[model samples]
Target chain A: MRLDKRAGLSPERCFNRPGLMKTDYRSRERRRRAAWIAFLIVPPMAMMLTFVVWPLLVALSSAFYRWEGMAQGEFVGLQNFSDVLFGDHFAALTWRAFRHNLFVFFALFVVQNTAGFLLAWFIYREPFGFRFHRIAIFMPVILSTVLVGFLWKLFLDPNFGLINQLLEMIGLGGLRQPWLGQETTALPALVMANAWHWVGFPALVYLAGMQRIPREILEAAKLDGCSGWQMLTRVVWPLVAPSTTITLTLLFIGAFNWFELPYIMAGLDGSPYGSTDVLGLYFYRTAFGNQSGGLQDFGHGNALAVLMFMFIAVVATLITQYLRRREIAL
Target chain B: MTAKAQSPDPLFPRSSPGSLIAAALLVGNSVLMLYPIVIMVFSAFKTTGEIFDAPFSIPDFTYVANFTRIWGETSLPGYFINSVIITGSSLALILLLGTMGAYALARYDFPGNSAIFMFFLAGLMLPLKLAVIPLFLQMRDFGLLDTRFGLILIYTAMGLPSTIFIMTGFLRTLPTELEEAARIDGASEPRIMLSIMLPLSVPPMVISAIQNAVPTWNDFFFPLVFIQTDARKTLPQGLSVFMGEYTTDWGMLFAGLTIAALPLTIIYIVMSRQFIRGMTAGAVK
Candidate 1:
């Protein structure tokens, strides 16, 4: 064996004799490689554990305890969960917020994802000015959601807003109302704003999927006398099933984690009789308290958060698995 | 090459009725998308009364009074500086630590490698906002509350998962010959990482940077919970408070919004391909 002195030890110290040389060198290299791996990976892993994993564990455990303003009082078992899921006042608000979230999810799926898909389809045809249209559609997606929510709030203002003025100019003045101040229109307005902010995302995803289609497949479909509608519904839709799975799962998560838009546009109370209240806003109010005299109840708040996390995780996984199963291999 | 070149026409002919309909729909959608933003920019140049009177009319582009007022009077400039500091610091840490972790995972065949990768991947599915209560309390205990460094740490932690994911994927695609050569030349592992691998990983670095930078720059929730001091507030939370104060001053609000949005908008317009690719990288993959 060639004795290599560059192993950071004298050959005599590293191995007792020549027979042990190869094994010592191999084991030393293995230890060195393991040390390097640990060195590189441990910082980020520790950061994740400290900030993410630890907080998650604390959130899970804190739900089972009585809390007095950031101080854990006693281990109350599942009482907090019961209070959030079934307590008199909490149950009604929880149900209302849950219903609003469902509405947001359905509305976003219908409006945002549909618009995105249609836009993607149109752009995929490479019509006149398609490049500019691609950029324009995605412009809003790049802006902060806070900015979009605030802008829409100003636009939907009753008197001095642009929407009302435009409605009057276009002879649709009768349709103008305080969109965010009313019970019926508030939730829908929030959904529309969110759709405007995010439609381009799914559009681009679908467009990418469309571009991946082989040219011969299109030719084959055309040779089979497929019309445009048939081509889209039959060929393109199934082919982009992976993108659909992604967009739908993300939409489900975003819908349940809905806070910023509603909080910005409609206020934390989700006012006009809580028409816009979502589980996110409800969790915030319960945990942090609001200007509307809601008390900070960390126990129930953590419980609600745990429930929200589980619901989203389970449903998102199921949706992903279901859609992934349906995706065409090609 | 010539035979392949003339193989097939596009799926839709340009003159067809269907193509025309597609064109019209696209144009209409583009208008729907761009008009509000244009109106916002124009209203930023007009007084509130003028904005109310002619909400859709083009304003004189020379009108800079609202901009001047927002720059001079509001705390927006301070918030802008704070956002820069926090985002810049957090991005640096994320890129550094993320690339290191990614390099280890991509290059080595260590035991438990896939398990560690899966551990990081789990962060993507679990939104950290769900654990705000403990995070808030922990920050308090660590004496990190209301400090920019606390926000930086949280953002770095929050950003590392996707950064590592993107970087690992990209780094794996790089040919191993160069790294192997560097290894044979007696370069240390970290030297190979920093000097060899990282230099070759710029595209994914940019992608990861843009992806994390946008969210870090625009995040409102964490600052709302962690930052109570006015001086440390980032743009989103600061603008929210500023909006509350200037509720009736539509021009000023628009100016503030414009200032808050201008950086990303310019970056997006310039590097739109990268922005789109970066933002959608997770989902598209």
Candidate 2:
């Protein structure tokens, strides 16, 4: 009753005061830590599970069943998957789409990444106009794909298009092809637009990576009889390999799941002979009927989506594994 | 700084005139980067007849007609409102849940911990469009289809991976001693988080919020699929409708595109430094 250290306990506290105090403190600490961890974890975990993880599993399961409008449909088994993989035009469509995607990847790899690297490298040497250059080049990266698409769509309107007008003014009217409407040029045009929108991101990333490289390394390279190209190839390139991995990985995923820009600029069907028809657009069309065409084949679309997912997952995993193995993290 | 600014090379020695060529090349490239936007801006001012008749010509008059016409005559205001609500609310939820989630993973050791972390990280690669059909169906079933809340929830889910990834790294970098000091001062776990760690993590939160918000505000696909009502459609989607309605209205379409793009450009200009830093931090890590 004295309200001292041992005031409230009974015979147990009296008999084992030293041990009980230590044990009680330890237990309380443990309980407090556990409670803290629990409160921090549970709600977000539950939300992620319900929304993200569960939806993925549901999508996977739905790949097998033929359903529409929430009504349970017959089990089609591997039919959907089969159609996506080995069906008559499915093979051609997927292959063609992938080929077009490969074009996008290579184009981005060469133009966007190389330009990004060069700009970052150049800007490092000359910090004048650094702020202006950074803002101007990276401006497109901040834009939404929708906005970029719309901007370019207006820019390349063929009749009132800026590019054609510029060409005409310069007496290069023959070079003014209907960029997005031509079968030969549509895919590349889309790729160019994408590269323009995306180059800023990689440039900024690479610039940061280059900045992190120790100044002494570059100085040492200079002493070692290195020119700008030699210094870049020998010192900077190897050091910035990690950034390359990130850039490539991002570009790969973006190329595969490319949807918004094409859908916006070229329409859902990718007119002028489906030249701009990426796998993403194809899946979107399949899953949800567009302005032109078929009943919404949810099952087939899910199947196609799963197929596309597997393709991307495998390629991405391989690329990541390869790049990870090769990258010498500084 | 001004003295150094006059001479281009601050770090590297200007060993040769090749540096001048490099500067020229850099300037040219920068112009390449800026030209499309420059043309787009100019095109917005050109009259429809001028757009075709003198497509390359500068506008004769600096006019407010295009801007006034789009906003006044179109559904742009409502669409803009929808975009604001969706992006703002979604960004708030994403930052809130993402930071807390990231803090838990970064600081605490728990059951299924790595597995849980991987579950979130895996979302970084799982493109949401792949699940568009099921998601749409899920929304329909839950009576969420076409609702702003539906977009918000989905966007939150979509943004979780990157936000968590970036936030986790940002939080992990904060010294654990701060939390321990708070604890030693008789602060509860929630109190420490609410008062200490959360405030310290605001920079990364702002970065993530801006990164996530721009895309959400300009998202046309989700709104296109989900929103059916004209009043409910977001700005980008509403602009698409405007484009369709005034297919040949070059002045109006360019004006709409300009309007849609202007806010993001403004935000970018204002926060370019943070945007660059935030983007690099998220990507590099």
Candidate 3:
């Protein structure tokens, strides 16, 4: 009774003002909130500004100058961009690299991801071999990309490779061919090897998504006369849509920025008439590699970086926009 | 999905004759995966002539020569040290900052939180190869060029997105009452996070360690870009140069590849279960 009386004290008696008590509490709360927000926002903002935003600005500024690492050169505004977009070697190399990237993207997105999804569906019901199979599939992803490239390179060697030997043993001598050394076969071989390494990752992802479906819902569908095919297409597929979106987005980015496999398999020059010359290798060579080409051109390199960044930013934004709209609120 | 829950227990499920045939065909895929590695490993033991002569056969004699030659002739040990240093430091930083960043985003309701998260997530789509030139310049500017620190920083920044994303999702499921009770006990925020929160975060932390550390250890791109000097090169780059130098020495090249792959394989075997669980959790989220 005494506490209630104290709480019910008139505004004039509390804090010596009519509405001061309420005003003080609210103002204090607002100050606390403002402090919290400031604390939360400052650190990340500063880091991003220094690392991401500043470098981008510097890249843009440097694109106009023919600068070496230490020395500065005459300003060449838009020339670097033009050279990257329209000049000899740059345009062709960029186009070819983009083309190769597109091929890699489609291949991984379709062949690897689809195969992975199917495998996930198949093995979901089998608990006996599931663990072993999962490990076996995921093994390649754990290995370094360089190791993968080397391993495949050894196996794909035309003369003494196990692949050609196996072909000979299987009574198909005609099938023996240079996998990485040949122009026609090099890029495809690299793609297959890459798929071999990465397919497990997507498969594992799809499996996780499949597992998220409630057992009860699946049992009910089964009792309602749903076949495996029907359930997979009609019920299970729709529920794991988010996984599909994430997998596709990641795979798309991975494919476009493909570098390590081609670098190792096709050499830094992307040999066999530059058949495996990807944008990644091309960019690296242009920026750093010095053989017949002149010393490192920081301006052209920066322009290339900026241009690639713009391309990725645009595509990523479009994908995010589309995917965000389609995301099921499960 | 329904088939799993509904199927009656069987000693050998899918025992039908036709299904048995299908199982055999499916199991054939295993041969595709394992046979190549098996052949290569065995071939490393065989002489060059013998490798071709009995390509499918086992080696006639054990050979330590290839192993000796690779370790003796190359700077692989230095590369190994380089890889360990870069991966170790990078993983440490990534986990440290990533956890703190994740905890903040997960627990707090600060303004523009999702926007901040989206900014980190953007790194996932931005491939480092595209930014190699700029990265080189930045490293040079910071005097981190050709150093392990450069590699570590690049990897930490590069890896932040996935680590933070995964860590936040894992952290969100944790009970908020514990944090509230800690706050009520007059514990400061950092104290609560370090003493209370960090202790409860071991499992996901270990999982992230394996996932991120293994890739960083095995990473080739950044090392290839930022590092040029022989002493600073990582195992992958060292192996690349080694392969170039010993192009014709198939045995030594195979040995180098095997040596580079051994540590990861061992680590994977030991923590295979956690790796799978962590991957599933992250991917599903």
Candidate 4:
């Protein structure tokens, strides 16, 4: 009874007394809340500002000047950006790298997303061992990309590697070549390796979307005499349009930012005559001198970085705006 | 929607020919996906000649020689410890601060909650890879250069957006009456958070934190850039170096890669349900 009374009556006394009890006591409550909000926001935000936001700004500003590791160099207006994009040989290298990135994007779209869309249907059917398949498929996604790079590099080794031996066993031995060491097969090889590492991500995402579809709609479409193909094309595809957008955007972004696989399989220079060079590896090579890129040009590196950011921001905006307009929201 | 009981379709057989095709496809894809991992595991045990000649055959499976060589001679153990430290400390920081920030943003009727929430979301799509140069410079300035502390801070901040984004979505789903009751009982807000919200929202939040942890543990880019010291390298960076030096030693290299991958693969298999649910839980809605 005393505890109940304390709980019930303290607030009444605190509120009814106006000046005496309310101001002194309730002010502390307000102060406590204000302090709580600040306590929560300040720490995480401070870290983001220090690392993510501030450094991005620094990178952007640093592009205008010709800065090295020691003494920041003289401001050269748009010289850095122009040089990285239009300078002798650098522009050719940039375009070649861009094409490789596009190949990565297109290859992922065809290999990963198509497989994902189909598997969502298969997994949705929940056949025997579907649950096990889902778990096992995502296992590689959980491993480090570095490890994936190493494992694939070994697998692609020309002599004793699994690829060559498998080709020989399958009676396709003549088709086998130096997979990661040839211009024709290098980018495609890396693309498949990347797809192996990440294909489950989209598969799961699309599966979740498939799961979220209202059963009533499916049943209604069936009632309307929709065939299997018609149902997939007319109803299910439209419903899962949002998943396609998310998957495609991530794929596109990942393509342009490609680094690890190429870096591991090819060297820092994206060797075999730079057939596998992507923007991320190219920027690193330019910024920090490698065997192919002779000098460390921080100015050109930052300019390339800024240019990549602009390309992403602009292209991402256009893609999302286009996709959002086409999305059939429920 | 399939959450409900399905009508018995007596007219159709359950295992139709089309599904037969799908089952075959599933089996085929599963092999393709697991093929390399199988190679990595078995090749670690097989003799060099056996690995080359009959790569398809299974090894004895009780291999200790390869493991010993890498441990005896290489720096794999040190890299593993560094990975544990970086992942553990960063995961702790992300969950603690990410949860508190998410709770406040979700619960309080603040002035700029929506704006702050948008800021967090925008961080997700922006490429952090592009900022490696300035991040290197900033770490140098703060005297955190080549330290685990530098990598820890970067991982923490880099993870905050998604962590907050997921946790906030989860926190908002919870009913508010419990929080109000706690408040009336004179439980401070942070106390309420610690005593109530954090515990209640842990499934989604920690899942988010684990999502962050997996990448941080496996990540090589940041460590490669910021860490110049050999002793400070994580598993992935160390693996790269080991691969470069031991380019010809397939046995030790396979053992090292298997060691790098084992902890995470075990977790994903054991907690696959929670891992999938936690991941999709954040993104689906």
DockQ of each: 0.61, 0.48, 0.31, 0.57
- Higher-ranked by DockQ: 1 or 3: 1
TM-score for candidate 3, residues paired by index: 0.86
C-alpha lDDT (0 to 100) for residue A102 of candidate 3:
86
Q: In candidate 4, which residue ranges exceed 4 Å CA deviation? A: A1-21, A223-225, A291-293, B1-7, B10-13, B279-283
What CAPRI grade goes to candidate 1? medium
- Please compute and give the TM-score of the first chain of candidate 1 against the native first chain: 0.94
The 10-residue segment of model 4 chain A with minimum total lDDT is A1-10
DockQ of 4: 0.57
Best by TM-score: 1
| Model 3 alpha-carbon drift over 4 Å, by segment | A1-49, A64-77, A220-227, A290-293, A319-330, B1-13, B16-22, B60-62, B108-115, B279-282
Clash list (residue pairs), candidate 2: none
Clashing pairs in 3: none
Q: Comparing 2 and 3 by TM-score, which wins? A: 2
Ten contiguous residues with the weakest lDDT in model 1 chain A: A1-10
Predicted candidate 4: what Cα RMSD to the true structure? 2.9
**Pairs with backbone N, CA or C atoms under 3 Å apart (clashes), candidate 4:** none
**What is residue A131's positional error in candidate 3, in angstroms?**
2.2
Candidate 3 residue-wise lDDT at A330: 62
Q: Model 1, range B62-108, lDDT digits (tens) per residue?
A: 99999999888889999999999999999999999998899889999
